[model samples]
Target chain A: MIEVNDLTKYYGQKRAISNVSFKVKKGEILGMLGPNAAGKTTAMRILTCYMPPTAGSATVGGYDIFDQSMQVRRITGYLPENPPLYTELTVKDYLMFVAKIKGVEKDKTKAEIDTVIEKASIGEVRNRVIGKLSKGFKQRVGLAQCLLNNPQVVILDEPTVGLDPKQIIEIRELIKNLKGDHTVILSSHILPEVEQTCERVVIISEGEVVAEDTPENLTARMKGGERVLLELEGDEKQVKEVFRTFPDVTAVKVNKTAGGLLKVEVESKKDLRKDYAQALIVKKIGLLEMQSDKVTLEDIFLHLTTKEEAA
Target chain B: MRKTLAIFEKEFKSFFYSPLAYVIIAIFTLITGYLFYNLLSWFVEQSFMMTMQAQQYRQAPPKFNVNLHLIRGYFGTLAFISLFILPTITMRLFAEEKKQGTLELLYTTPITELQVVTGKYLAGLALYIVLLIPTMFFMALLFIYGDPEFLPVLSGYIGLILLGSTFIALGLFISTLTENQIIAAIGGFALSLLLWIIGWGATFTGGTLKPVLEYLSILVHFEDFAQGVIDSTHVAYYLIFTIFGLYLSLKSIESVKWRT
Candidate 1:
């Protein structure tokens, strides 16, 4: 549960974030989608009470970031862009120290650490020195550190960056596992990662929120038209003539591919692949391949983030 | 108290996680031991020379006061040695945490700023104590063969610890100003050296400024403690100095959060 209202921050002459506002419902996984320097980290830092906002207010778990920052911090767990780690300390020692400062019960500190260590899958490396571990393990250790104190709100900044593909999948799964209990707000530049992991997406660009919706709703909202590709083994002259029978096809372009096949690209406002396929079948033409292209998440992101610049 | 001790435990233990702690302690012990040995041998040689002169002239030689000539002399050297060594312990206290980004962890947690500062300051004091332990052993050797006034020697230690606590406060404040360890060390040393010698200005200027400078000079107040006099004024001065340094450090840290 978090609420941010008209948050703005200025580092001297330069404005880092301006009039940024967002909210996370209890137990909801919210994705902060943006490119680098999109002020996502700045927004998260303000929420965590790491720094005060220049001209706005925010509350975490009903405790204001300014007036009751200690209470706000008690319920919030934050993993900064770089995992704040002591390279010399062992994993267990570091976790113990975090638990102590997080105000966990003295008798339960170990058990609580074990719980997060198991949750983040860092048990194997718990005894090893943290600095000697791999990047993925270090990131998991960071997650484990955030999980201490049984915090209700977990704010992670680019948790999957700089990891291998397999590690990325593992971390995404781990974050997904936090659902139903912890309200997660993760920031990332990766669109598909946000789409797959978050229940609600807030797309931010240039320090402002450009769009916010569910993945499917965002896709539907950004999907303006459709493009289809059809490859047929028939006469080029007949292919050019076949377009006349379809009244729905707004435009068509024919490309002559090698091996005597015609590549026909059809543009229309509706789905017409079945209609065209049947037409080709009735004409006794060999339908070799057909694939339709819908608007992808990347296109929507780029459009939303860049349209203001162009305007 | 729980939060303070948690931070104190971590900060104190982390020092030994590197070779630097062992090296600093060993080097300090060796240098002080060598200096103590030279002072003792010179004292013994001087006493023997006085006895020979008394036998030759049949008159009494000047009394060779062990507390004045030997233990006090060793303490004088130790006070300056601590000036050089104590800042190195404190220079890393806040600066390293800021550099490693661990201050974010502390700031974002439930711990208070006072708890964090006290934890770190205590760690620096602990290291100074450990550095002084072997010199205590060196002083125990004095009790084995000669009779030095035990209270004066103990008071001399009180002086050094007070002096060290003051230096740590000043150094901790300097450490809070920057993220660079080298700059923290050098800046802390330069400022501390300035405070240690501030009394010298009293000779050049006469009037209110002279007493003010003398009162402010950390070295001048330490003279009472080194002379085995636990004057409450000197104790109050060191305490106030220490508190002011801690207060400045707390403000610097708060400024970092607010300003940035």
Candidate 2:
């Protein structure tokens, strides 16, 4: 539902984003993973028709952002980093005003508001002033505002930035439920949050797209195929040699821990924990701890972003 | 038009919800009420003096126009008070949105800049009109007690509304230039006061310079309407001035979008 090509934006002499491009398919939840200042907000701003890109162009719902901005804005709902709210107004009044501006029909304004209020689960606080509400409620009210007009595209910029863990989980669930109905572009620095909620992830770093794929594919495609950790009472060199000689073992590293135990990290294409545990016993190397873990999005993100910085 | 009305409705209702609007209206009514009372006393004292002189000289009292003596002075004071009060009203128009980050919501909406500016301008103008309400009660007192030429008083109000529009439009433009409400209020007040008094330079200069200064002065156009004259030149001046201010506001909004 959205296509961005070489979108660049410069605030005066400082370039906020440069030649950044990405796409979101219809009814897909695409997560934009990036640290702060990674041009995520800037890209979303350009897509929402909040501001025009300095170079190149974008189209939303098959309408060009520059020439058909009204159409783009009409169909796209945006929630900026800070929830745009009037502190003095009640939640219902605020939603009613937004509906009028968003062009909800006069006859349906109240029903449309009721639907959003129910969706964001803010019905309990519907009559309460927004400023007096809790942060979680305020964030949900922001989300409720986006659901107005039933826009085909919903773009949220760091929707769960400062929320507590429970609120984050609730928000993630709400976003996950938006699948197959509304095209969502969510930007966040939290990798696990993206991994859990998004169908596809776009890893952005230094104003560039480093990787774009499913979370599973991203973790699997990075350098580490499989990883095994072993804490043992043995010579570091002997432990490394054994894992190096093991079938499908690609690389191994050993370091001494505080407890006088050798910590061995073995990266291989295949799992050999059962075989390796037996071999260690036969070699008379005492095993204190043995654990195997799959590569996570955190590992891939760090590797991709840090590698880009190094180059 | 519907979008503009939506913005206007929200803004207009917000003014009543805040204490600043009530304070401004209270202070404005008190000052104008005091001036009207004092003017009424002066008019009565002057007429009493005229009657004494006529009776002593055995002659009829000459004509004394209440519209000139009372209504004109009341309208002038209203115009002056609005210059100060309107800035505070307009100060919060765009500055508050910018300060609270609601400008992002406005920009992303499908509404155009013209609609936004027009809606805000109308809201401020409406409040300025509301500020004139108490004084209207004062004007009604004059009609109940004595005969005053109604057309002159009517023209004076038209002039006051026009002048208020000029102040509000200029102040609205200033609000768009900053996120700080204090700065917007102070900047708008200073610029408006400067324009109101810019014609004073006519006293120091001669030839073509004097006319230019007088023509540029916002107060000069309103002075004609305050005195009961409805000259088309003065009407054109105020219309042009208001449009120019609104034009600047629209241009500034556009420039902000393109402020790369």
lDDT for each residue of candidate 1 in A194-237, tens digit (9 for 90 to 100)? 98999999888888888888888999987666678888999887
Tens-digit per-residue lDDT, B60-111, candidate 1: 7768788888887788889888888887888889999999998989889999
Could you tell me which 10 consecutive residues in candidate 1 chain B have the lowest summed lDDT?
Answer: B218-227
Runs off by more than 4 Å, candidate 1: A230-247, A250-265, A278-288
lDDT of 2 by residue, A237-290 (tens): 788777867879888888898988998888888888988899899889999998
Q: Over all chains combined, what TM-score does candidate 2 have?
A: 0.96
For residues B1-260, could you state the per-residue lDDT of candidate 2 as single tens digits?
A: 89899989989988887788899899999998998899899999998999899999999887888988878887888888888888998999999989888888888878898999999999999999899989989998999998998888889889989988888899999999999999999988998898899999999999999999999898888878888899999999888889999999999988887878
Q: Compute the lDDT for candidate 1.
A: 0.90
DockQ, candidate 2, comes to 0.72
Label model 1 with its docking quality class.
high
**Model 2 chain A: worst 10 consecutive residues (lDDT sum):** A219-228
TM-score, candidate 2, first chain: 0.96
Please name the candidate that would achieve the greatest TM-score relative to the true structure: 2
